[model samples]
Target: MTERVCVGAIAGAFGVRGEVRLKSFTSQPNDIAAYAPLYTEDGSRSFTVRLTRPVTGGLGARLSGVETREQAEALKGVTLWADRDKLPALPDDEFYHADLIGLSVHDTGGALLGKVRAIYDHGAGDILEIHGPGRRRVLLLPFTRAFVPTVDLAAGRIVADPPDEQE
Candidate 1:
C-alpha cells in the first residue's frame, strides 16, 4: 500500500478568480477539504484546500498559493494526494483502492488469475479490472462478496469466483 492516496483532482479554473473546479474522489465529496495539505504525486508541492461552493460537475475550491486564474488553470488535471495516516480507517469489509491495486488474484481452486489493474465505480457498484499473462483482453469483475469471496491484504491476493467468460 502507498503512503499517499489520491483524494481529488483540479479540473481547471472555476472562474476568473484563483478558485479551481475540484473533482473529489472521497466517499463524501466535501470531506476532501478536511484532509488538508494535500500533495502532488511526486511530493514536490502541497496545498490547503478551501471549498467555495458546489459546482456543476464538482466543487469549486481555492488552493493555497494559487492566487491567479492562470495558476489554477495550470493545475488542471493534477491529482491531489493525501497521506494515508490523515484519512479515516475503514472497517474490515472496506478496502482502499490503492491497497487493492496490484494485488494478485486467484480462483477458489488456487489457479492464478491476474493482478488488479484498476477499480471503477459506475453507479451500480465498484468493478475490478484484472489483467494477466496470455489474456487477450482485461477481465472486468464486479467487486461483490459473491464473486470476490476473500481479500487477504496481508497475503496480497484475492480469491474470486468470477462468472464464466463469454469468449
Candidate 2:
C-alpha cells in the first residue's frame, strides 16, 4: 500500500481570486480540508486547503501560496494526496482503493485471474478493473462480496467468483 492516498483535485480557478474549484474524493467531501498540507503526486509541492463555499461541480477552496487566478488555474487537474496516517481507519469490510490496486486475483479453484488495475465508483457502487496476461480486454467486476469473496491484503491476493462471460 502507498503511504499517500489521493484525497482531492484542483478542477480550475473558481473565480477571479486565487480560490480554486476543488473536486474532493473523500467519503465526506468537506473532510478534505481537515487533511491539510496535501501534497502533489511527486511530493515536490504541498498546499494548505481552506474551503470557501460549495461550487457547481465541487467546492470552492483557497490553496496556500496560490494568490492569483493564474496560480490557481495553473494547478488545475493536480491531484492532492494526503498521508495515509492522516486518514481514518476503516472497518474490516471496507478497503482503501490504494490498498486494493495491484493485488493478484484468483478464482475459488485457484486459477489465476488477473491483478487489480483500478477501482471506480460511479455513484452506485465500486467496480474493480482487472487485467492479466493473455487477456485481450480488461475485466470489469462489481466489487461486491458475492463476486469478490475474499481479499487477503497480507497475502496480496483476491478470490473472485465472476459471472460467466457470453462467448
Candidate 3:
C-alpha cells in the first residue's frame, strides 16, 4: 500500500440518527472532512465526512454509507487515514508524526541514545519517546530546540542534548 497519514479518528456514535463523534488530528480540526474519502487503517472501508456540529471532545459528523446509530457505534476508535499526497505540505519546522518514528537519536557528543518509538502531543508540546536497544525504559525528550538541537531528516537521525542525571 502507498503511504498514508492518520488525520482523524471516530470517537463513536454521537446521536441516534447515525451521526458520529470524530476527533481530528489536523491543525484545523474541521479540515479533516475536507480531505474527502478517508480510508480505514487497513483500507477495508472509505468514508466521506460531513461535519454537522461541534460536540464535547470532538465534532459530530456523518459518514457516507453509515445510516444508523448501530453502524456508527461499531466504528468506534477507528483511525481515519488519508493519502500523503492529498494532504498539504508542512513547513520546514513542522513534521508529521509518521516521519519522526523509527529515526535514530544521538547525543550532542555523538553517543547513541535511542530510536524514536513514538511522539505525543498533550497540548503543551510534542514529546519524543525514545528507547535504546535492550532497554525497557524510555526517555521522553521534549521536541524543543533547547533539548533537540538538530533534526536531520535526510540522515534519519536527531541530535539531542539530554538533561543531567535525575535528582
Candidate 4:
C-alpha cells in the first residue's frame, strides 16, 4: 500500500484572497495544517494548508499556490493527502479510515462477507461500508466496539457481529 492518506477536501473558495473552504477529516481539525504539503489523489498536485479561521462546516484555508477565488474554487472536491507516516500514531483501539480500506470483512463464523469499501461520517458517527458476493452490499455498520468487536489490521480483516435481524 502507498503512504498517501486523505486528510481533507477543498470546498470551493472562501474569499477572493485564495482562501478555500476546507473540510478536514482529522479528529483535531487544526491538525490538518500540521500535515503540510498535502497531495491530490494522483500526486500530480500538492498544497500547504494554512487555516485562516473557523467556518461553519470546517475551516477557511489558504493553499500555497492558489491566489484567487477562481483558483481556489477549481480545487473544490479535491481530497488532500499526506504521507501516512506524518500522521500521529493512534491508540490501540483507534484506527484510521485509510487503514481500513481494502481490509477483508468476515462474519464470526469465518465466512467471507466483503471488503471495506468506505467509511462514512454524516455528523452523527462513522459507518463502515463493506462490499462483497451474495453478502456483497454496503452495510452501514456503526464504528463502535459493540458493533464491530474486532479489527485485526495485522490479519487484514474485520470481525463483524451484526445486529439481530429485525425481519
Clashing pairs in 4: 132-136
Per lDDT, the best of the predicted structures is 1
| Candidate 1 per-residue lDDT over residues 40-118, each given as its tens digit | 9999999999999999999999999999999999999999999999999999999999999999999999998899999
Candidate 1 ranges with C-alpha deviation above 4 Å:
none
How far out, in Å, is residue 9 in model 1?
A: 0.8
Error of 3 at 73 (Å): 0.7
For residues 57-112, could you state the per-residue lDDT of candidate 3 as single tens digits? Answer: 99999999999999999999999999898899988888889888999999999999
TM-score of each: 0.97, 0.97, 0.94, 0.93
Q: Give all candidates' CA lDDT scores.
A: 0.95, 0.94, 0.92, 0.87
TM-score of 2: 0.97
Query: How many steric overlaps does candidate 4 have?
Result: 1
After superposition, the stretches of candidate 4 with alpha carbons farther than 4 Å from their true spots are none
Ordering by lDDT: 1, 2, 3, 4
Which 10 residues in a row give candidate 2 its minimum summed lDDT? 158-167
Worst 10 residues of 3 by lDDT: 158-167
lDDT of 1 at 83: 95
Q: Which stretches of candidate 2 lie over 4 Å from their true place?
A: none
Query: What shift in Å separates residue 27 of candidate 2 from its native position after superposition?
Result: 0.7
